[model samples]
Target: MEDDIYHVVREPEFTALFLLGADDLVETVEDVDAELRLPDGTRWSASFMTLGAVETVMNRWRETGEYGGGVFFRCSDLVIVPKGGVPAMIEAFRAIVADGPQETLGNLG
Candidate 1:
């Protein structure tokens, strides 16, 4: 099996500062349902709900300054590092956000 790779689809001028700023704007919970461990031994975890919610907040903040909601993680706290490359991480997070809790969790009837 191969690890999934996601590419950042944002504007070409997007910089690390923008991603860092978005990271600073997030709030993570103490518990997480899913996690990804990096090659460096660091772990990243969060529920489908939390990831989706934070993605919404980040998108809003990026497009407009009308962001007033909070971002959080469920199973574990949300931590945004440039591991796996900043763009790849950002894109993966975006995909997770787009999938949302219900879809990601496969809550289909």
Candidate 2:
């Protein structure tokens, strides 16, 4: 259920995005050489590459008719679920986006 949280956070030079499916967790982190690390242990390698690769992954899964009951979203640079999944993932994304990183959770670092 927790694995339903698909996210990708990065600074200016790198991008890392992951997708959570009903039966699988597909993830991608590009620019692995730029040396930027997010709290989730994902790192951005460079400054130009984007989460576009992440989109590609999501699109692939969406095209597959097999994964039919998962939540779905295209968060900033991350894509999450399709059809249906744990509700907590949505709440988590909201909390993380609205309060955790920008103006609140000073300790999420």
Q: Tell me the deviation in Å of residue 104 in model 2.
A: 9.2
lDDT of 1 at 31: 17
Clashes of each: 8, 14
lDDT tens readout by residue for model 2, 47-74:
2123454455456677774244223533
Q: Candidate 2, which segments miss by more than 4 Å at Cα? A: 1-49, 65-101, 104-109
Per-residue error at 42 for model 2, in Å? 17
Candidate 1: which stretches are off by over 4 Å? 1-75, 78-83, 101-109
**Alpha carbon lDDT at 12, candidate 1:** 35
lDDT of all the models against the reference?
A: 0.36, 0.36
Give TM-scores for every candidate, taking all chains together and pairing residue i with residue i. Answer: 0.22, 0.22
Ten residues in sequence with the least summed lDDT for candidate 2: 26-35
The residue pairs found clashing in candidate 1 are 29-73, 31-74, 31-75, 31-76, 32-74, 32-75, 32-76, 33-75
